[model samples]
Target chain A: MKILVCISNVPDTTTKITFSLDGKAFNTAGVQFVINPYDEYALTRAIELKEAQGGSVTVLNVGEADTEPNIRKALAIGADDAIRVNLKPTDAFLVSQQIAHYAQEGGYDLILMGRESIDYNGFQVHGMVGELLGIPTIAPAIKLDVNGSTATLEREIEGGKEIIEASLPLVVSAQQPMAEPRIPNMRGIMTARTKPLKVVEPVGQDAKTSVQNYELPPAKSGVKMIDAENAGDLIKLLRNEAKVL
Target chain B: MSVLVVIECANGEVKKSSLEAASYGSKVAAALGTSATAVAIGDVQANALASLGEQGITKVLLDNDSRLHDFVAAAYVKVISKAAESENSSVIVLSNSNIGAAIGSRLAVKLGASLATNVVALPQINGSSFTVRRGVFSGKALSDVELSSDKKIIAVKKNAVDIETTAGGTATVENFSADLADADFATAPKETIRQSGDILLTEADLVVSGGRGLKGPENWHLIEDLAKTLGAATACSKPVADVGWRPHHEHVGQTGITVSPNLYIAVGISGAIQHLAGVNSSKVIVVINKDPEAPFFKAADYGIVGDATEIVPKLIEAAKALDK
Candidate 1:
């Protein structure tokens, strides 16, 4: 069972988001990029599944050269190799197409990805790739297990979870509860340098959507504190002053 | 050409998010100066589909496929694609749900349409060009996206559009078939297990969510009782789910389910931007936290700087006193 995990380079959760001077694009200056938190679950789960059954885990990313650090980190965490599609991920469609192009020839038994990228918050790549390849996709799956050729997963739904089973050569977008992310130790970090880092050119697809502009949200007003004992006063303010009630 | 709206149904009724999608699609249809048509999937009754007229839908196309009662992404995409072509729909609308996000992306690729998920507001149509403001940065910011395509698909965020109830309006229900092959059912669910909850997150009028500040799993009963009294659904932040303190289904964040209820009560949540992205669209946000510096207070309409253990009990009492 060979697994391919899709990872994205996104700003750390603690980074303060700001726009460039023209206010048209995200300002990346001085911001540290990390493996998208959601993708970590997918990578970790893939590694675990590979460990249970003898197989290989390959990590894929669509980004510029700056994304190699996180790609190496995924390798250190136990991916057998990595694929870097050398292109700035402009949109979800182009990224999905790049991934699908790779998966088409890789003969991977399973493909895993994060539910959504934290930066763009576009939850479309996994399904788009699945559709392009004409395979099944189980999205936002919380639990995943592999048994020979069949894989079972529990996908999160509105009020419950849906248990689904699919054969090999399927796509799964993983979320929390799938597995705990493992931090890279010294030994793994040393071994990651020797792992193969394959760089491929992107087969571009026209992005149907483009960002017109980006705007920061309105600054929140200062906190209005009331006595803890007078908690009911806050409710009154919500009903009368804010009128949101 | 008409606009097609996919109405998801369960238990003989339409899902609340589907109603919101119907309302959104109708508005899109009105913008295009055409009527909105609906495609119903699953084991939904004809009478229930007719009720979609309240949302300004004129025709409801029913597939009546029992296999579709359980969500199969391949089968659903095929059914929706057939419906869209039959109606000659250039524009499609859906609720930004797990199913919607999964299926909408594929449909957009298949139909060669521009797709936007988590859309919060109506489209700004400047002649033929369509632009929409969507929540980004996990609800910390908004970005205006221009869709430069002839066809467009928009997945409206839950609770972004008000559910309009019109009296005595009924839509014509017509049976349709997609002629799915056995291959379409190849990925069907071998088994299904659904957790029973009083209120669904997408449809609930009120929600009570907990976070790591709730101390541990043992104190969850306080949050549960308040949710029960208010007839609200229970939810949690991503960290709570990551730590195994709560079920992953209850996790609300960029990674979890994005919901917009009338009232959202957060207990012991620190209000991370990722978590706020999922609930920021709620009509009213109430935060109960001991830390005054919790980031959630900034986005919350109402804040109580107190311990959840102390405040939740009082809230349950206050709620119980109100007539159901």
Candidate 2:
């Protein structure tokens, strides 16, 4: 069995956000980048599946060369090898197409990715890739179990959860409670230095969407503090001022 | 040359987000100088369907597929695609819901349309170049994206647009079919389990959430009492869910369910950036924590420094009194 896992590089959760060049693009200056937390769930689940079922896990990313370090981190966490599509991802459409092209050429049976990247938060790539490859896609799955050729998945719905079943050669967008993300130990980190990291040119489709500009959400007003001594006063404020009740 | 809105229904009525989607599509239709056609799947009341005219829908094509009562992603894609083709729709609109995202992305590929998700505003259509503002970077920023395609699809963010009611008429209801096949049902869910009686967190108007500061799961009664008193939903921070203090469904953070309730009262959880990403969009935020320096107080509209165990019970008592 062979598995493909997709990972994304994003600003760490604690990183303060700022834009550069007149608010045109993200200012990465003095910022630490890490694997998107959701993608870590996907990578961990893929590694677990490979370990249990005896297969190889290949980590894939669509980004510029600067993202290679994060790719190497994924390899250290247990991905057998790595592949980087050499380009800055323009949009979800083109990213899905590039992934689809590679997955088709590689003929991997199970493809997994985080439900949505923390940066773009598009949540479009897995479904698009599934459609591009003409396969079944299960998204935002919280639980997955494999038995021979069939995979059963548990996904969230409106106020509920649904159990679904699909055959092999399937794509899944995974969420948490699936597996615990593993960190790179000293041995794993040392060996990952020599792991095969391949760089290939992007193929198929141009970005259909382009970022015209960007803006930050309005800064929060200073907190309207209420004393804890008179806790009942909050109800009055919520009703009369906030008028939310 | 019409705008197509795909609405999801359960039990017998339209979802709030779908109503917003209908209003959004109808306005798009008016802007395009064409009618808006609605295609709804699953079980819905005719009266409820006809009421869509309030959102400017000209006609509603109802596909009462029993199989659709349980979401089948492939079947839904086929049905919506057929409706779009029949209406000659240049634009398709849906709620940026789990169901919508699942099918809309595939439909974008199948129909060869440019797709946008987390859309906050209507498109600024200039001749052929359509640009839309969408929330990105985990709702930290808004990015204006130009969709350079003749066919375009949009998944509107929940609670993004105000529902328009001035259309002030009833829509024509038409029973429609897409001749769904067995293969389309292949991806059908085997079983579904729902939260019994509480309001759904995402759709709730007021949410009462707690965190590890409550001390233990047994103390969750304070959250429940407050939620019950205010008719609000309950949610928790990631750590509260991670340590099995609360069910995962109640988790509200970047990695969990992102909600935008009208009022979010957070107790005990130190505001982490990931947690803020999910609940920051709430209209009114109230924070209660013992530590004055807790990060959540920064984003809160109203804050109190106190222990949740001591503060929550009194708040519940005060809320019940106000109700009487």
Candidate 3:
């Protein structure tokens, strides 16, 4: 089994988000970048599958040179090798196009990634890639298990879960509870330094959408702190003041 | 050029978010000086489809395919694609749902359209320049994106748009078929397990959420008591789910469900920035924590500094009294 797991570089979940002066892009100065939390579920799950089934797992990323450290981190976690398409992903369409171009050539039996990246939060790539490759795609899956030639998944729907079965050569997007993400230990970190990290040029495609500008969400007014014993007052406030009842 | 709205139905009725999408789509059609046509999927009554006129939709196309009763992404893409083509639709609107995102991305590729999810507002179409405001960075910020394609697909966020009521007449319902093939249903679900609850988190106007402050799963009755009294949905912070105190579906945070209910009450959870990112869009926020310095109080509109065990039961009693 050859599995290709896709990862994305995003700011640490606790970081205060700020855009550049022009508001066209996210600022990188003094900011720590980590593998998108959701993608970690995918990467770790792929590694677990490879360990059990005796196969190789390759991690892929579509980003510029700045995203390498996190790509290396994936290798340290357990991927056999890595591939980075050197391009700043502007939109989901271009990013999906890049992944489809590579996955078609790699001929991996299973391709997995997070349900959505934290930055843009497009939630579009898995389906786009599946469409581009003419394959089946199951998304936001909370559980996945592979049998001889088929894979069973528990996918999240609105207010429910669906049990799905698909053949090999399919795409699945990871969400919470798929698998616990593993941290890189000292031994894994030492060996990852020598693992193959291939950087390739991006394929050509025009991004269909472009960011014009970004605006921060408005700040909240100060809170009205009611006393602990007066918890019942909060109900009246929600009903009469907020009018939300 | 007509605008097409994809209406998702369950239990033979249209979803509230789908009604908001219909409202948004009808307004977009009016902005473009065209009519808005809806294509209903799933088990929907013809009368329910006709009621879409309340949201300004003028026509409804009902597809009674049994294969579409359960969501199949490819089949849905085909159905919407054929509807768009037949109606000459340039803009397609849907709810930012699991089903919507699954098909929106594929349809963008299949129809050469620009796809935008989590859209918060209608497009500002100024001569060929179509710009839309969408929530980004997990609702911490908003971005204006320009869709340069001739075709555009938008997934409207829940509760972002008010349902329009000016279009009062019943929509003309028409029978439609996409002539779907067996291959389109290749990935149909084997079984579906629906969550049982009085109110779904995404559709709820008020939510009562718990955190580690409750101490253990044994104390969850406080959260449920308050939720039941107020008739609100129940949610939990990520740690509670991680520790197995609650199910993953009840988790709400940066990597979990993002909801924008009218009122959000966080109990015993410190306001982590990650948790706030999922819920800052809420109209009114209330935090109940024993600690005075919990970060969530800063974002909340109202707060009570108290122990969950002591304060929650009182709140439930108060809510019960108010209901009378």
Candidate 4:
């Protein structure tokens, strides 16, 4: 079995978000980049599958050279190799097109990625890639198990979950509870240095949508601290003062 | 060209988010000098279909296929695409739900349309250039995006738009057929497990959440009681879920469910930036913590510095009194 896992390099969760002076681009200075948390679940699950099924797992990223450290980290986590579609990802459409272009020729049995990137939060890439490749795409999958050529998945919906079955050559987007992400140990870190990291030029059209500007959410007002004894008054405040009850 | 709104229903009821989407679509249609048409998915009752007129929808298209009762993305895409093509729709609106995201992306590709999800507001239409504001970076900031395609798809975020009800209006319902093929149902679910006997966290407008300060799962009744009194859903911080004090589904944070409810009440929780990222879009926030300096207070509109165990019961009593 050949499994392909896609990863995105996103800012660390705790970083304060800020845009450039012109507000057209995200400010990157002093920001620590990490593999998107959701993608970590995808990568770990792919590695687990490869370990059980005797297959090779390849990590793919559609980003510029600045994303390499995280790509190499994915290799350290257990991927056999890495492929970087050299480009600065601007939108979901272009990223999906680039992923589809590469996976079409790899003929991998499974393709996986995060449900959504933390930055864009579009949650559109997996479905688009599946449509482009003409395959079944299951998203927000919390549990996955492969048996022979069939894969069983638990996909989360609004208030429930569905147990789904699909054949090989499927696209899936991982959500949390899928797997606890694994960190690179000393041995894995040493081996990752020798792992093949191939960087290829991007093959895709321009992004369908362009950012005009960015604005920070309005600052919240100061809290109205009610005395502990007057806790009941807080209810009145929520219902009348805040008008949210 | 007309605007098409995708209405998601379950057990014969339209979802609250879908209602907001319908309202948003109709306003957009009014701006374009056209009426909004809805394509209904899932098991919807006739009354619910007709009631869409309250949200400014003038017409509803129903496929009435049993296969659609359970969400099959391929079948849904086919149904929606057929509706859009027949109606000559240039703008499509749907809720930024899991199912909506699944269908919107595929539909965008199939129709060669540009798509935007997590949209917070209506498009600022300037001739051929339509720009929309959407939440990005997990509610930390917003970005304006220009969709440069002939056809545009917008997935409205939950609680971003109000559900406007126009009085005493009824939508004309029409039968729609997509001639769905067997292949469309090939990936259909084998079984489904639904949460029972509790309000859904994602759909709730009022939420009461607890954290490690709640002590343990044994003390969860305090959270549940407050939630019950307020008719809200129960949620938890990431640490609570990670330690198995709460189910993962109830976890609300950057890596968990991102909720934009009308009111979010956090008890005994310090607001990490990650946790705040999941809920900063809330219309109002209230924090109850023993520590006065918990970060959540900075983001909250009202706060009480005390042990949640003692404060929650009093608040619950006060809430019940208000109902009386």
Using DockQ, give the best candidate's number.
4
Cand. 4: chain B TM-score: 0.99
Candidate 3 per-residue C-alpha lDDT over B1-324 given as tens digits, one digit per residue, 9 for 90 to 100: 999999999989899999999999999999999999999999987998888888889999989998899999989989999999999999999999999999899999999999999999989999999999999889889999999999999999998888887655689999999999998898899999998756899888899999999999999999999999888999999999999999988899999999999999999999899999999999999999999999999999999999999999989888989964
lDDT, model 3, position B231:
87
TM-score, candidate 1, is 0.95
The true-versus-predicted C-alpha distance at residue A157 of model 3, in Å, is 0.7
Question: What are the clashing pairs of model 1?
Answer: none
DockQ of 1: 0.59
What is the docking quality class of candidate 4? high
- lDDT tens digits, residues A105-132, model 3? 8999999999998889999999999999
Q: What would the DockQ be for model 2?
A: 0.80
Note the Cα lDDT for every prediction shown: 0.86, 0.90, 0.93, 0.93
- The alpha-carbon lDDT assigned to residue A79 of candidate 2 equals 95
- Segments of candidate 1 deviating more than 4 angstroms: A221-226, A233-245
Stronger candidate by TM-score (1 vs 4): 4
Over 4 Å off, model 4: none
- Please estimate how well model 3 matches the true structure, expressed as its whole-model Cα lDDT: 0.93
Per-residue lDDT of model 1, residues B1-324, tens digit only: 889999888888999889999998998899989999999887689999998999999999999978899888889999999999989998889888888998899998899888998888889987888998887877767899998878888888877788787888899999999998888988777776766646787677788999988999999999889888767889999888878888777888876777778788899999887788788777778888999999899987678899988887776665555443
Show pairs that collide, candidate 3.
none
Q: For candidate 3, what is the DockQ? A: 0.89
Q: Arrange candidates, best DockQ first.
A: 4, 3, 2, 1
